[model samples]
Target: MPFTPITAEQRFVLDHVVRVRELAATERFAAASDDVIDAVLEGVGAFAAGEWAPLLRAGDTVGARWTPEGVRMPDGYAEAYHDYVDGGWGTIGVPEAHGGQGLPFAIQTAVLDTLGTANMAFALCPTLTVGAIEALAHHGSAEQQRLYLPHLATGAWTGTMNLTEPQAGSDVGALRTTATPLGDGTWRIKGTKIFISFGDHDMAENIVHLVLARTPDAPVGTKGISLFLVPKFRLDEDGRPGAANDVRVVSIEHKMGLHASPTCVLSFGDHDDCVGELIGPEHGGMRAMFTMMNNARLNVGLQGVQAAEAATQAAVAYALERVQSARAGGTSRDAVRIVEHPDVRRMLMRMKAQTQAARALVYYAAGQVDRAGSGDARARGRLELVTPLAKAHGTDLGNEVASLGIQVHGGMGYIEETGAAQFFRDVRITSIYEGTNGIQAADLVGRKLALGREASGGGVFAELIADMRDEAQDARLIALIDACEATGQALADASTDDRLAASYPFLTMVSVATCGWLMERQGRAATDDAPFMRMKRACVRFYLEQIVPEALGLVAAAQAPADVLYAVEAELFAE
Candidate 1:
């Protein structure tokens, strides 16, 4: 099957759902005129489809190989990456001052959406680098920015966020990575960071690691943690990658998918000389790291969109070509394309609708980021509220759609040769990383909900519901919005145990309603009734009629008492 960049879909989302024109209207993003935006979408789409798509099969099969020297990427990856850099794809969202195109973040996300759909494992390299650029742009000292931001913004050097340790999986407070201040401005970073993606790759000349560590006199927990800029190679006076830093790839994880992305166990200062500069103030690591993490979270959500898009494309192509049985109710007895069958049609429609919904959700969030960057306080709060939804539910949709893609393929999907299974394996990690989807749910109820309240009198969540109410005319969407409101209010008064228990379901209800709202808006925008518009209208109809109603059942789950969840004794679970 062939993989084409969802260029038309992305353009539609940007034009209608995300409204990139509004971003262009802002003085900061004035350069992102319609012409420039379209060119970017078309150019990146062509580059991704022509350059990266070819590497997808080999990325899964050959993967990235590791040795003492470094992790060698799949063949043609270096050349493709060079072209990616040379083509200026990585510079879309970076600031003009940093040698970039200075476009809206949503446009950059569009680039990743296309490329990741082509080759997700390969796309992870630039994803983390974008996060690093953001972190440095926000928190790094002026000298640090001058020294590093240019190379990073240009994609000459890649970046990695090193937060995970063997024991500190989700608990950042438990990390034991130590950063001792030298008499000079730098510090010695020592500890092992596990599951560092693109931690050591040959794609760039140097890797800038944003590491989280604690100082000698710092307090315990995340409050005491600090962020460090630890590069693979120390820069000389001229700011080029000079001597090798003490960071070493202990080994890369042999994972279920994304094999081409080397998930590394990195040993920093193994010989006791890894040098790093403090990114922000002492004991401000968590705050600084969040700058990077927040950026990555949205990109991770986009990864979900990427996977969904890829899987949907493959499954749809497969459904149209594979002959199976006659239609459920048809005149001919002869076998027809599987797509003619009602059940397969159902599966294909679900995949397409869900993929579009997820893409809209992510693009909407990216639009909020751009607005927030342009000094929209309301958009900032909205961005905060929607980030988790986009990260968790978007990825959740990815997993669900990928699984459905496999089901649509029947048994051929079970075998690796058909290439349907790779989407599932690669996307499975999206829900688990950046912060597990469960953790994202917890953050939604525990933090974002309250923050939204503080930021606005009724809070951003309420504002979202209000926006949906204003935009939506469908009764199903309206009903879901009402249910979301009820659950949100109830959870606000609930106990910690209750809140956590209902968090996942509540997140789902809110996500589906929000996506449904966006889908309705997209439906309204497609009034011309062209073939694409008709299909858009159809998918929106299916989503509201079939998918939106599913959220109704979750209302009970979202309001379920926590006692039932804890009723059974934990010790007897093994029985």
Candidate 2:
């Protein structure tokens, strides 16, 4: 099945669940009228479905290759990227002062969903660029912004975040990359950054690399790190890309999936003289990088949602066409479509409900970002609280749904030709990158919940639980909310090690309960007697009765003692 943009579903979530209209009422997004939003959705949907979707299979099959010149993309990718740039799709949420459309991030989130569903590998390039745009717009000096923002916003120049090295995967403080000051207000950046996506791609004129490195006399850990704006090509007096910089793409990683995206190993200043300018205050790289990290994390969650959507579509399409077992009760001897079977139907419903639930949560979080843009402190806190859940649960759903997609195809799914396995392969990365799901769970329990009350005037988790309880009209939903509240309180009261042990299950419970809340709202708001609304009602019903109950077990698992996890001796497994 060709990729289709879920425009109606996106609009429904934006209007009913996310309340984008309320966001529009704010001064920051007041100019984003209904027509503007609709136009963007329609245009991007067409571009994604027509231009980008066709390249999906080719991208996976042909993939990207590293050459002596640069990282060469798959066939038709450069053309598609050019079309993306020409269409102005890259600038939806960027500020107008930087030659962008200046729309709300909620709208941008919807656009990203469409793009990601069409082709995740292609979508990743823009994803990193958006993060870099956020970092520069928030922390870059005026001169730096003037020099970089326009092309970046316009997609003429792409960007990459360089924080990880061979030794520093998640523990960024352990990185050994270095930067030395030059007398001309520039620094020479010397380091090897691994897993740098789009690090040396040929689609754009210049690649703006935001690097994290420590100064010579700086302290030993992350506190000593500083951010640098190092372009692939140095700028001339006219501010255009001029000479080649000292950044080299040593090689690209051959990954399990998203092969078309070049995950490069970058070497900077191997012979010295890689000029870079400081982004923010010295020794404050982590603070500035968080701006990008936060943006990318939510976008990664949306990647999960998109992959699930794509997988579900393919599975349903296959189930309808592939004839298999006979009808359970009928007299007919002919084999019926597998979709008619009870188990297949159950699997399909599970896929649909989980995907919709993830979509609602992510869109709601995006709406909170828009509110935060308007200086709403509570909304900001709410966003921070939900970020981990959105990242962890959403990707988990992606993996689950994709696996189900393969099962729906039965024997054919195991073969690469069926296309069902591709989703499973592609979605596996969403949980690992942008910080692993385990890291996200830890952040939720150890950091967010621990300090949420002091930062936001009230506990974020507590406030969300209360909101869910208030909105939950069904008894089951209310019960689920209560369970989530109790688990959250336990996390609050538990010791650090206990909280860490419980973090994963607690995060899962939060995601399920929150989805139940949003689904209930979606059900209430969907009043039409149309088929789509009927499907919405059925999906929400299945989610509440069949899916939400998983939270009960998660709650129990979350409160288990930490000692249980480490009780076994390390060498005993070998025996």
Candidate 3:
């Protein structure tokens, strides 16, 4: 099945669900008119389908190869990347001063969804660059910005984030990478970083690595960490690539999926000459890195939405064409399309409903991000409340939907040739990277819900629940809203350890309920004349009746005592 961009669904969410035009009314994004936004969606959708989608299978089959020279991408990848730069798709949301279009982040996310759906491996490169752009724009010094932002924003050069190491995976404080002050406005960085995506690629003129390392005499743990800008090549007086830096790609990891993406182990200052410049204040690296992490987290969530959408599209197409047994009630002896089968229809409906719900959740978060940029306190609070749920639940939804897509294809899906299995393999990592779904759940329960000034006295979730209640026009929606409100209060009152014990379930409960709210709103706004609207109505109904009810059980599981979770002794595994 050929990949389609689902621009109609995207436009519906932007217009009715996310209300993106409200962002256009702001002075910061006033130039992003309706016409410009639509044109951008159309252009990027075409490019993704025509130029990038063709590379999806080849990328998986050929993968990226590592030579002594560097990492070489699969065929047509370089050309596609160059076309991406030439088309100006990478800089739609970057600031105008950085040689970009200065559009809203919502538009950028919409494009990301299209590109990610078309080709996730290729899309990973630009996703990292966008995160790097966000970090630099927020924390870089004037000289640093002047030297790097233009090329990075224009996609002439690419960027990577380096944080994980052999000794430190999620525990950043355990990293052994060190940065020694050069005493001349630079530092000598030396250490090994692992799992660096797009770490070494031949797709650009240069690569800028945003690295986290510790300075001598710095305090222990994450507090001691500092961020540095380590380029693959040393810059000349003219500010272009000149000589090789001390960084080397030791090896790239062979992963379960995303074969085309080079996950490299990078050794910095192996030759004792790798120089780096501080990105922000010394010992403030964690703070600065969060800017990039937060950006990446949201994009990761969108990747989930994209994966679900892609899988659903493939499964639906396959179901309609793959003739099987005769329809259950039909008099004809001839076989009917599998789509007419009740089980297949149920699976497709689940896939479609879940994908649409996740998309709406992600787009709503994007809208809040745009508002947060304009210094809306409430929007910022809502963003903080939703980020964890969006990241964890959205990716979880992706894995679920992809698995269902596989089931919809039966034995054919298990075969790699059908491309259904590829979606399942590729989307599995979305739950693991950019902070695991487990970490996301912990963040939601531990930090985000803690009552404090930063949380605006813990009213953000409460306010959102109130909004859901007010928006509920249908009886089913109102019942769901009431259940959500009760669950929210229970979660708020739970002890920290108790919350952590049930964190995953709690996150699921919140996510399902939030999606129900959005889908209800979408149902109300949908016009009934078109087939698309009728499909939307059916999806909404399926979601509410078959899916949203799961929240009730999740809420009960989330409030269960922590002791029960630990009742199973460790020795039981020995048997």
Candidate 4:
């Protein structure tokens, strides 16, 4: 029931996507090669094993406590945070100017999985900090960056994205928090933002809130929304904490999981004389915030993979040690461990394969981000196109793999103490937060595929299909390729009409297809001696038999006409 490290299967799939090695003698990764990435992977694995692994049960058992000033974290949470920061794990992906290691995004993702798997609640504090750095880098004024970036990158003060209100979940257009712009540069903001992470805490001196509120004279809906930098404690020119900012943690939520992470009900403008400054241009806040959104979505996908990987390894270990029923050909006198049975072996195999496939897909997306943002034009174009798919598909892989992990544990999974339930609960939020799977799929259909269609999209997909065909010499890879082709065709056949109704199911098929495709590629690309290659082959076979059938139905449903979505018989239920 304990969380574990990357399985053989995960390493194999991700290997296809990332080039791992130790860092070179040279200090920087800008001119550095795979060695930097390799050392990063090793460092992450070591950190998870040595530090974070032992904290899983403790994090859950002693979740954060609420007090009059703010919520207090676990006993050793602060020390752990310091370890991660002092070790430079927190700033690996950011630029050098902001105290970041400034390594490749792919390497950063590889390391993030380790932290997430160790303790999602504890991992979250810094995860949000990284996102804040990304946002501030993109939108913060020069002065703001100088004041905040250094502190945030060093984890001196954490940051939170305040976009969600009670009335405004997905619909930012409905946001009503008013940012009253003063005659001077600053403004007095007043509104409540719920579900704000690290909103009020003693963990750091100041909290830089990237709050979303409407300007008084602004237009209604999303157009009126703007980004404001409201610190928990105002900073002086030397960057020391000064007067208190208006934002406060009125109360924290008692949630299903990640209890260690205080989900605060934050009051932004409750106090008059609450000082705030605009991040980017007025009313352009939503546009600027997307930097964080895109980054967050990718991290969430990694979380999905991390949870599944940890759960998969734990389940396998449990199956290895825990004695259960007798083997198929064995007598009642000799009961075998769960690992000895085909069905149990099959379950373990499924978990391993899915986790690996997901890891590969998420890592692949990280590579694309580097390429897309790089100076290379082709890399940029291809990355923009694949971003949504990576986020959506990776998350789907996470959920499916975690579900298998739970099922593998049988009754033990249903119990909270076993820890599989925590993974299940934590993973649920991946698809919900960082933009729902539906939103991700919509992004794929509306942005990636649509743009692909316009900009030689057919050729892009054709090349993808052709790549599989090119590698069709291998029998196992061929079968995976075929399954992927089937799923992709079904997805291509979908339109906006029925999508609203069957969106979840339809996107589920796409995710399966995408991961299956990657599995095939990883298998084709792997060496015979690699355990991951063998794991990929096993998952490819299992997915073909079990998960592919679901895709068939999803495809059939996606093939339905748009109007059919509303053809439901609600009256039948009433009767």
What stretches of model 2 exceed 4 Å from their correct place? Answer: 455-458
lDDT of 1 by residue, 165-254 (tens): 999999999999999989899999999999999999898999999999989989999999999999999999899999999999999999
* Clashing residue pairs found in predicted model 1: none
Query: Stretches of candidate 4 above 4 Å error?
Result: 1-4, 7-15, 19-32, 331-333, 457-495, 528-537, 540-553, 568-575
Every model: Cα RMSD to truth: 0.9, 1.2, 1.4, 3.3
Name the TM-score of candidate 4: 0.90
Query: What is the C-alpha lDDT profile of model 2 across 243-272, one tens digit per residue?
Result: 999999999998889888889999999889
Q: Give per-model TM-scores.
A: 0.99, 0.98, 0.98, 0.90
lDDT of 4 at 1: 41
Poorly placed runs, candidate 1 (over 4 Å): none
Clashes of each: 0, 0, 0, 7
lDDT by residue (362-396, candidate 4, tens digit) is: 77777666655555555555565555666776667
Q: Compare the candidates by lDDT and give the number of the best one.
A: 1
RMSD of candidate 4 to true structure, Å:
3.3
Clashing pairs in 3: none
